[model samples]
Target: MIALERPDDPEAFFEHAAALLAEGIAPEHVSWSGGESADLFAAATRAPRAKWRGEKLFAAALLHRAENRFSLVYRALWRAARAKGWLGNPADPDLCALRKLEGEVRRDSHKMRALVRFREIRDAEGERFIAWYEPSHFTLRANADFFAHRFANMRWSIVTPDLSAHYDGEVRFAPGGSRRDVPAEDARDEDWRTYYAAIFNPARLNLAAMQSHLPKKFWRNLPEARVIPTLARAAQNRAEAMIAAPPTAPRFSRASAPQTEAAATDLADLRAQLACCEKCPLHREATQVVCGAGPLNAQLMIVAEQPGDHEDLAGSPLIGPAGKIFDEALRRTGCDREKIYVTNAVKHFKFTLKGKRRIHAKPGAGEIDACSSWLHREIEIVRPKVIVAMGATALRGLTGQILAVRESRGKMFDLAEDRRLLTTTHPAYLLRLQDEQEKRLAWRAFLSDLAQAHAMAQA
Candidate 1:
C-alpha cells in the first residue's frame, strides 16, 4: 500500500490526485491516510501518466464537501483517465454522490453571497466594512470575488469560520475568526430597512415561500428581520388600501375588446380577433398575443400548453429552449416541422415577475377554459387529420377533462369530424431531467410518440 498525506483543500486535492494518476497508481492500491495493508504493486510507481478526460472544477468543488473525498476523487480520476466516456456516465454511484455535493455547495455559495451583512468599522485604515458568515462548506474563498466586483468602490472584508477574504483594490485571503470579530451594526442599516419597506408588495405575500428563501438561520443577520413580521401582519390592510388607490394607469386593453368567435372566416381573421381577446384576465399582464405558426392546410397539428418567455416576446409558439428539443425530436423521427401546424392552448404567456425575469406560471383551470374558444377556432380553421397534444395541459384543452399524459401517451383517441388525437410528453418535460440515463430514456419515448403521430397523419 502506498501511504500519501491527505490533501486539506480543493486545490491541493486536485494537484495530488493528478500527480497520483501520472505515477500510474491504481486507486485501490493507494492509501491517503488509513487503509488495509496488502497490495501487489508494493512501492514506487512505474505506470505511465493516464491522460485526464474529466473536468477539474467538477471534482474540486465536491472534494471540499465530501467526507471520503480523497478516495472518491481518486477513483473518479482513475476511471476518467483510462476509460473513454466515463465522465459522461451519470449512472455511476460516485457521480451521483458528486452531483448531490455540487447542489449543496452551490446552495451554500448562494447563501454566503445573499446573507452576509457588512458593518462599517474605523481603524488605522479610516473606514472599512467587515462581515462574518458561517458557511456549511468551504465556500468563503469561492464567493469572495463576487463581493469585490459588486462593491468595487468600497473596502470590505468577509470573515468565515474556515477563511477570511479582504478586498481593497485587490483581493487577499487571510485566517478566519469567530462572529464576535465583526461589529453589531452600522448607520447604513437604517437606510437598508427603509429601502426594503418601500419595495415590499403586500398583495403577493407568501409566508412559506419567504421562509424557504430567507430561512430562520439567516434571520439574526438581516437588518429587516424585525420588520418582516410587522409587514406580514399588516399586509392585508395595506393590500386593500393599494387596491382602492390604483387609478394611476388603466390596463391598456383596446377600447372595444373583440367579440371573439363567428367573426373569423380564415386563420388570419381568427388571429386578428385573438389579438384583442379580453375573455381571460391573463391578457392584462402578457406582452402581446401569441398565435399559431405553420401552414394553414397542414395535415398534422401540434398543440403545446402555452408560450414561454421567448415566445411571449416574439409572438410565436415553441421558439426557445423547448423549441430546440422539439426540433431535434422532429429530426430524429424524420418529421418535417414546416409541414405541420403548431400552436398553444393559451394564447397569452402567464408568468410572475422575479426581479426583471418573468418565470413561467402554469395556467389555471379558469384560464384554460377562457382560452378554449381560440383553440376551438384554430381547430376549425386548420382541420388537420391528426392532432398531437404534447403534455396534459394540451390534452385537457382538447377533451375538457383532466387525464394523465403518462397513462394515455402513445394511444390514439378518435375525435369528431374524422380527426384523431394522440397524447405525448412535452419537450419541456425532458429538459427538467438531470440524469443522463433518464434523459436518454425520455428522449426515446418522446421520439416514439412523435414518430407514431407522424405515421398516423400520413395514413
Candidate 2:
C-alpha cells in the first residue's frame, strides 16, 4: 500500500494513483511531500488522497484520513513535518490555526444560511443599506452578489468573524473588515425595531414560524429582538381584550318595519325576492342580481365585499379563483359547505377596462352604503348563527367602519340578536403575494380564522 502527498496538481495525481490502483498497487506503500508542491505530487500519485489548494496540507490530511484514524494520521504527519523541518516556527501560529479554522468553516457553512438575519439600513445620504451576519465563515464574500442583486439599489454589508463585505449600491463584492461596533449614524436599530413592530401582525402570531425564519441565535444582534417577547405578550393581551370587549354598536338605527314573526317563512320569501329584485345601479350594469346560496337554515354566512368580474358574469357569488380558494379553506376547516351560505356585501361588479382586461375597482363608501340595505335585508332573512367577513370592504359594510383587518381577523364579534361575526383575510390578498412562503403563511392564517369561525359555530 502506498500513500503519496502532492500539494499541487492533486487531481492529476489522484487520476494516476487510481490507474496504479487498477494495476494492483497498494496505497500503503507510498509516502511523499514537497512543501507547497506537495499537493501536486499527492494529486498525481496518491490513490484518492484529499486535495486542498495553497498551504492547507494539514486540513487535507485530516480530510483524507477522516473516515480512518484521522487524529492519529494528523499527529504522525505533524511529527514528521517537524522532524523534517517542513513546519514553520512557533511565532506564526496563524498558519496552523487558519488551516484548522478553514476545515471547521467548511463543516459549518450550512448553519450560516439558516441563521443570518438581514436588516435594512439607510445612511445620512438617503442611501439604502442592509446589515447581516454569520458566526465565523467568510461565506458572505462568496455569496454577496446574491443579496446585492436582490437589493441592487441598496448599500449593504455582511459581517463575519473573518471579514465583512460591502456593496456600494451599484457594484457588489467590495471587501470590508470586521468592526467592534457599528457606527451610531449607520446603526438603524430604532428604525428596524419600528418597522418590524409595525409590520408584524399580532393576530397571526406563530412563535415557531418566527423562530424558524429568524433563529434565536441571531436575536441578540437584531434590533427587533428587544420587542419580540413584549410583542408576544401584547398580542396575548390584545386577544384577551378582544374576547372581553363589548360588541360594537350597530351602525344604522333599526327601522320601524313590521317585525315578521316567523324567520323561516321570511327567509324563504327574501330568497325569492333576491333572485328578481333590481335594487341599485349594479343591476343596470350586470345581467342579473346574484344572491346568497346555501341551505335555507345555514348556520354560517360568508360575506365578500362584492362580486368579481366572473361572479358578475355568472350571476352568482363566490364562483371565481378567490371563491375556489375560499372553498378549499372551508373544506380544510371542516366547515359544511352545504350548511354555509356565501354572498357579497355589495351585489355589484365595479371595474375599469384596461385594453382587453377589466380591472377590479374598489367600491366607494357611498356604494357600500347603498348596498348595506340589501346586506341588512339578507341578515334579517337568513338569520345566520354566524357571519364571516372576508375582506375590509365586507367588514366595513357589515360593521360600518374602516377597521384594522390585520388586528381584527379571527376574533368573533356580536352582530344584532346575539349573532356572531368573524373577520379574516380576503383570498385576493393572498393571490397578490409573489413569494410562495409568504403566501403559504397568509393561507395558514386565513385557514386558522375560518377554523375558529367553524369551531365557534359548532359551539
Candidate 3:
C-alpha cells in the first residue's frame, strides 16, 4: 500500500494522485508522508498515499487492485478512510467511486426488499430457516448489519458475487462462495406462478400501463412472465368475442321479484292501474297516461325524464320533438328500437296551461319519489340488460343524488348484478338551448354519450 501526505486542498491531492494514476505506477506502489510541505512532496513524488501531519491525516492511500482480487482489504481500508474523512473532498474521483459503491449497496438493499422470496429451508443440522434471494453485486458485507437487525431470529443467507452473509439465529458475514446444495423447504417458483395467475384482472387489463410498470428485465425472474403473452392474446380474443356476442338480456333483481312478476303477469292490469294513479295531480291536466312501450324481453331500457305534450296525448314514448331527435340519434348509432324498452321516470304528465298551450313542467322531487315505484317495477319485470338514464331526473330516480349527473353522464356504473346504468342528457335539454352553436355542441355531447353507452352495452 502506498502512502503520501498532501496539503488541505483536495485539488492538489487529486492532481498529484491523478498524474501518478495516469502513469504506469499503481496507487499502492507510491507513498507520501508530510504536512503543509506535503503538497510539494505529493507534486514531486506524484504518489497516491495517506497524508499525515504526525497522527493527524487528510487523505488515505489508494490501491489499484481489481474488485474480486482485494475486495475484503479494500472494503476495510475504505471504511477506516471514510471514518477519518481522509478523502479531503466529496468530489474526489476516488471518493466518488466510494459513494457510487454506497449507492449500489443501497440499491441492493431495496432490491432485496422488493424481490427476496423467503422459503423455509433446513440446514444439514436439521435447523429450519427461510432462504430466498439473488443479489447481483458485492453488497453482503457492505450491508450485513442491516440484514442482521432485520432477520435476527431466522437462519438465513444472502448470496452475492463477492461474499455470502448468514444469520444462524445470529448475524455473521463470511468471505466465501455460496454452496448450491442447500435444499429450499418451499417451492417458490410454483407458488409465484399460482399467485401471478390469480391476481391478474382480465376486466381492467391495460397492456401499455402494465408494461411500463413491470419492465422486461424484472419479468425474466417472475413466473408470471411466461403467461403474459398468452394472457394478452386471450384478452384480445375475449374483447372480439364481446363485440360478436348479442346484447345481454334484461335481468330482474331479487329485490323486485314480486313487482316484476306482477308486471310480467298482466300488462293490461298494470296499464289499467296506472291510468287511475293520482300519485301527483299532473294526470288531471295532462292529456293521457303515457306508459313504457317496447318488447317485454328487450335487452336495452331507455328511461326518459317525462312524457312530452305529444307523448302525453299519443300515450307512447319518443313521439315529441325531443323524441324525434332521439330516434335520429339511435338510427345513427345503429340501435334497433324494437330491441329496447322505453319508459319514463315520471309516469304522470306535469304541465301549466297558457291559453290553449300546455308547457311542460319539470317533475318535483315528490312526484319523482311517488313515480319511482312504477319505474322500479318496470325495471324488475322487463329486466333490461342495460338502463339508459336520460336527463337529470331519470338519473336521480335511478342512482340517487350521490354523484353529479353532468360529471357522471358518460360513464357506466354497475347497479345490481350484471346490470349497468348509463347516464346522458335528455334530447329536450338539447332542444331547449336557444344558441345554435350551443345546441350543436349539446347535441354532439349527447350523441357521443349515447355512442359510449351503446359500446358499453355491447362490451
TM-score of 2: 0.44
Model 3 residue runs over 4 Å out of place are 1-266
Clashing pairs in 1: none
Q: Report lDDT per candidate.
A: 0.80, 0.65, 0.65
User: Which residue pairs collide in model 3, if any?
Assistant: 3-31, 3-32, 4-32, 4-49, 4-50, 5-32, 5-51, 250-383, 250-385, 251-383
Ranking by lDDT: 1, 2, 3
Instruction: Answer with 1 or 3, whichever has the higher lDDT.
Output: 1
- Per-candidate TM equals 0.49, 0.44, 0.43
Cα lDDT, model 2, residue 154? 61
Model 2 residue runs over 4 Å out of place are 1-268, 271-280
Deviation (Å) of 2 in candidate 2: 94
State the lDDT of candidate 2 residue by residue for 1-459, as single tens digits: 234332222344444444543454433444434222233444444244433223424433332212232223334344434467545544444345545544664544555554445554557866544454645333554455666677676666666644566767544443444434343233567777798888877778899998875568777666678888988989977777767887564343346322323323465576565555455565566656667778767778889988888898897888898889988988898887888888898877887789977778898887777677667777776778888999889998887788878877888777766688889988889889999999999999999998988887777
Instruction: Report the CA-based lDDT of candidate 3 relative to the real structure.
Output: 0.65
User: For model 1, how does the per-residue alpha-carbon lDDT over 1-459 read when each residue is reduced to its tens digit?
Assistant: 333333235555555567778777788876553222334556655323333444674644442545565677678778877898897998999887777777777887888888888999988978899998878777877777899899999999998776789999999988888889988788878887888899999999999998887777677777877688899999999999988883321111122222354657798888888888898899999999999999988889999999999999999999999999999999989999999999999889999999999999999988887887778678878989899999888877776778888878888887664788888998999999999999999899999999999999999
Candidate 3, 127-165: lDDT as tens digits: 554443455443444456777787776667765434566
| CA deviation > 4 Å runs, candidate 1 | 1-8, 30-54, 237-459
